[model samples]
Target: MKVLGSGQYRFERVESWPNVPKYFEMGQPSDVAINSSGEIFVLSRGKHPVTIWTPEGDFIGSWGDGMFSATPHGIFIGKNDNVWIVDCGAHVAMEFAPHGELLRTLGNKNSASPTCEGRLVHAQPFNLPTNLAIAPNGDIFVADGYGGHKVHRFNSKGELLLSWGRQGREPGQFELVHNVWIDSRNRVLVCDDENDRVQLFDTEGKYLEEWTLGNPSGICIRDDIVYFAQLQPFEDKSNGRGSGSISLYNLDGVLLSSWDNTAGGNKDTLIGPHDLCVAENGDIYVCEVYGWRVSKFRKIQ
Candidate 1:
């Protein structure tokens, strides 16, 4: 799966977890989250279950076998150590205990309509939820991506507070609201991915401002820095050998350092890097779609 690009970036491939089930081998790795214990959780597309691995690349465990029908999009590890898995296939969000226990699942498991008050009624009828963010008050925010293009907020008990956003390319409008994260100020940052930018808003969905990132997919905010996994342009006919790059930006959307994927060569160069997570120790874990592997990068300086 090595791919070479005209740019200075090269992609390399890395073997993952030795041998796992055949079903886990392929699909796009959509979102990644690292827990307080340094465990990496990846929401992959090929299989309905989410895979968990140690920071050292050891297979820790896996769960959510048949819970999703389409694709598991976004994932996050809360401050309380609970794992939140967002299933775009099921059009719902689920919470699991640290040890893989099912704490609570949100959304109607068997609804067929797209307009449910508190949760998703029909799986494909509603907006596809991409990623999730937890507020300081324990409120959960789900970025409804493909279907309806809205951000749904819920209380700890799964009660709907409010939902906003519609389909458009304008500043307040969201063409593809891919991911969301809460900063230290409790402001919500939505990765308006398709718009080629990241838009900042308050918890109430008020439009603040946005900054470009070429083709951004996933984002994580740590301290005063925000890390973005920017995918290659889709229109390029390079036989999927496009080189993805990671960009570091500040809270005000100022560009810092940019890392070309050449660290792994062509195959290891990130292809369709959808999600990323930063460990407490400043290590970064990136999940890729075409490569089907998670790579870790550490800060040298």
Candidate 2:
């Protein structure tokens, strides 16, 4: 067993995690979220887009067959156990019940806002929206990252509330607005990927703070801690072959610990870690697009 961290935030890679059915195939697993009962929901760009499994890696079932575009970017399970899937290729976001019932959808399928051949001309609903986070009151915050640089807000019923962001390195602007999350204080945390920082804002989109965390591709909050899955590193962002790592911090942006997956050699290496979710017990599930698998890191101290 390969260990991947130290101090209070150590983890051991589960070499045999997520035992899939023999005939099943996973095509670029991108994101993961754990429901109320601790069931892990993985969103992938594959024949079966949504796959459910126990925390112990036992396969439960699957859903969303033929219901998504070729690229599904993110998966988020709200506090109420509603599943949200951001279809990047389709330029839409969908919400489903815990039992796989289609609840509602945001944006038009295959229809993105006006863009100049994949470049953002203006801020709008979605031009390849990446991820979403639900506030305690059910407000939806989406990161319209790819094909556009913007963050969109919506009410519980999926009505467009507002949108903010542009293409820049400034505070409110985003070079690549990737993942988003709502913390205990209801503050909005956005992963500005290319900017090499995570920007903080109020629910109304007011810029408050920013933290330098190399190429943060995914972020999640567990208790008083913030977990970020960094995609490679800032220096290696363009090359796409550097080892990404997981970093933990306090709510106030104080770095607690960081784990470099490559420190344990090739077997424990993580490539293109796009998303991650921390279990209640502190175990972490990471989704890698390039690695094409969801690997578990069991908390060991």
Clash totals, every prediction: 16, 0
Off by over 4 Å in 1: 1-27, 110-126, 235-238, 262-268
**Candidate 1's residue-wise lDDT over 1-301, tens digit each?**
4432223222233445324555545356778888878888877776445777876677777776666766788888899999888877677778998777888877754342363332342223345677888988999988877765778788888888887777677877777878888888777888888788888889987888888777788889877678889876543456755567788777777777666556434344566677898877666778876566677665543
Tens digits of per-residue lDDT for model 2, 47-142: 999999999999999999999999899999987898999999999999999888998889888998874243454456788889999988989999
Task: Give the number of colliding residue pairs in candidate 2.
Answer: 0
Q: Score candidate 2 by TM-score against the native.
A: 0.93
List RMSD in Å for every model shown. 5.0, 2.6
In terms of TM-score, which candidate is strongest?
A: 2
Candidate 2: where are CA atoms >4 Å away? 115-123, 233-242
Clashing pairs in 2: none
* Top-scoring candidate (lDDT): 2
